[model samples]
Target: MNRKNFLSSLLTIGAAGPVLAAAATPNAVPSVSRNTAASSAALPTPLIIPPYLRPGDVIGITCPAGDITAKEILPATQLIESWGFRIKVGETVGKKDGVFGGTDDERAADFQQMLNDPELSAILCARGGYGAVHIIDRLDFSPLANRPKWIIGFSDVTVLLCHLHTNGNWASIHSKMCNSFPDDWAKAEAIQVECILSIRRALSGERMEYKVPPNVRNRNGRAEAALIGGNLKTIESLAGTRSDIDTAGKILFVEDTGEYLYSIDRMFWHLQRTGKLDRLAGLVVGGFKVKPDDPGEEFGQTVTDIVTARVKGYGYPVCFDFPVGHQKDNYALKYGIPHLLDVQEGAVTLTDTSVPAAATPSL
Candidate 1:
């Protein structure tokens, strides 16, 4: 089906409304309404802060989406281990079940085990491909809802993050996985080194403030709200499902790679028509890498232009080319947490305001 038709079908399902209220149980992250605005009055006041990783804490690594070999993650595993943390490689890692790391059952089982393990302070995804969507809904997130730990990765892992955020009110990290880390920074590009630094900072519970380079397409303004969104394709895929995020009055960040320019425009239009863009407190556009135009046909608009057009009069701060996506400089973002986005004279700054000033010890 075409994008329009597919989006319409999803909207129809969403309009039918949620079939059941999220079960209220101990250690369950309370679910919020999909249509609720993100204003302080609309959202629940309680913010769930997962246990931050401390020295010697254990991090469990699992492949929830794509197939990956043990060799590919060795560098990242060793790096984290060197950071005074223990690493637990899941059973599914290096076990190929066709194009996936393992069967859907295996993938879900591995991730589920990690989620329920109190010894694990975080679960690091091995990599992202296409299979995450298949097992996302199958994972029982309730056990980890209140006793939260970081869920880390981007791309296809967006499905897991969105589901956990929307249905369980859990916070997750949008950052690099094992496959993206390099063993030798001396031979790696500067950006890859930055990626590793970002991961380390995130794991160490350091609240980050970004001075985003100016983008001509950016709308000059400021607002503070919870941050949401990830890979554009993954966000689009969650539409009409239980995982669909409620962006009302929230700062939504999006990025994608290897897609036609026209497809990105269509996805933005989908967001607009579905009212996702209308209620945003801000919009952040990250790296759109290797976007191509058709051989004989051109979209005649850059990703920047398309985004600017879609969010034209909304007036919320819109920062483009903010590094986060299928790129080496992909910085980590904490989703489902309040952040301040300020766009002023020739600069953009994003500050995480979710954590209390006196809360956690810094690295």
Candidate 2:
């Protein structure tokens, strides 16, 4: 979609309602929040973030993707602090009017400033609501190229990840940030601590293996591949553009939140139709918060059902309910790390390839 239509779509989706969509099945009726298990008997381990985080690292929080709920800022900062890093809230952090976050110029500026800031160890987004596409076109990554650090967020920020992976960093994370972090950090401080520490490990080149919540039913094939993906909409948007992800032979992890089951199907359909979904050696679905249009048809085919329909015959292992989306218990995954995914005997273990420490940032 061109920038004009992209902007229009944002307004349209928002004017309709806040996102709370779920996949609906014709006969199944159940609470939407109930997590659906992956239909595949086993799954693979997700890629780990490069461990570059340290206690005193200065992290920059910017609003490049979407407008954050203004009220959530202070508390979000507290959550970042709870993880032990100080945050520099950008001038555009809370930029939002109706849906576009900030004026294209404003959002672009926030990203530009952070990319240029040498002191900021990483620039994390405040949210990913239908805006990054607008600003990405205007960005000049000279600063980012000079001082390479983590640029984190999911959903819309996937655009940034696509560009960064191809042109600059050779690494980044399609993980959580901003409003998404607080709820987790405030409660599971240690988990938050581990997450930060884990990212640090990935970045600093001290890679061993990160945690993957044990899955009883995982894809049994053991293979190594790169970690890549964010919201389905964002990834799908990359279709046809130069930044379209090359999923061929990679472990593709996909997740999204607040999408209608049909919309979810449509996005994946784009992937499938475009041959993007066909190349993956394995597929790991992140948390899906699917809502049905008709209350009577709650599990309208279910998230798993749609997933199975799209991926079942592809010959690659498919795992569902894996952590990588807009869920509270999502995992922090490195977008470019290579690791082993073993779904054997109903267990998924993501083992690192045992490479030397990750290269230090150029600047």
Candidate 3:
């Protein structure tokens, strides 16, 4: 199956089971606390900043999902190495087990080793296709919780980030992976440049802010809360699992690609029904690409319409077309860190509050 279909299919099956009940279980609930309270919790200190990559520091690249060739990652590896860091490719990079880069056990083992390694400054996924869900439950994140290294990627990697953020209270990047990097950095688009620079800023503990164009459906207001959410399909797949997000008083940013409008609607309804939409500080709707209706069927509402309708009564600020998701302009955002979202007439600004002014450079 193609990447999108594979994600959808796996998530839909998960939806069929006792998702609501499973999500509501006490152990599965996220610890949605304020700065002080969250710090007090036994949970791995929230927003734990991993050690930044320095010259000679090694970064381990592992394929926790879809199979990828060394050639596909060479460009990204070279770019990173040129930045003065070392690259340690995992065994799963070129290995294929059906649709996945490796079998569930194999992928888990590779990732576990990286998590346990002290020499690696970060572990980035080779790509996000589908297998993470199969191995999410098998992998132990306790080592990561202690070391708190940067874990990067999006789409299916949402499983890993969510696990670290919720269960481990660690900060992780929701950004491009090895597969997204262009071979020639000079040929990259403006948005691609933004994405790459943002990744660097995030790794270096730099704060980021976005000046986004306003949308008619956007709610005019402001909010400050921890950022969370990623691929809607993957988030849906995690509804009942341990990785499911608890969005209470948090800014939720969601984006998806290649799904039917009806399916998107259903997913939103599920989020609302499960209390995922309630009491949020704000919402950011990123790129919803190629959302076609099924044959002879129409959902009759744009994604903005669905979102605005769902959050109509709430006063929280809402912004649309924020440069994120499958698009090249997919700005890197820090999950589990506090941020400020100011939605005003004609424009919106999103600022990361966790990092200091001196630390956050313009990306």
Q: In model 3, where do residues sit more than 4 Å from their true spots?
A: 1-45
**Minimal lDDT window, size 10, model 3:** 4-13
Model 3 C-alpha lDDT per residue in residues 209-321, reported as the tens digit of each score: 88887888788887777788999989988887777788777888999999877788888888899887777778899998856777778778888888877887676778999
Cα error, residue 83 of model 2, in Å, equals 5.1
Identify the leading candidate in terms of TM-score. Answer: 1
RMSD in angstroms, candidate 1? 8.0
Give candidate 2 regions above 4 Å deviation: 1-51, 69-71, 79-84, 183-218, 295-300, 352-363
Estimate TM-scores for all models. 0.87, 0.74, 0.86
- Candidate 1 clashing pairs, residues 3+ apart or interchain: none
Clashing pairs in 3: 207-360
Candidate 2 lDDT over residue span 1-363, tens digit each? 011111111110111222222222221122111111212211122221323667777888888766776567776677567667778888886667567667888888877888778788788788877877776657765443234467877788888887655432245766666665454445666655555444445544455454355454445565566656777878887787645676666667888888788888888778888877765766777788876577665546667778778876566666666656776565566676665566656455554453543633211
Determine which window of 10 residues in candidate 2 has minimal summed lDDT. 4-13
Model 1 over residues 181-236: C-alpha lDDT tens digits?
88786799987887677777777777766777797767888787778899899999
Shift of residue 131 alpha carbon in model 3, Å = 0.8
Question: How do all the candidates rank in terms of lDDT, highest first?
Answer: 1, 3, 2
Cand. 2 TM to true fold: 0.74
Between prediction 1 and prediction 2, the one with superior TM-score is 1
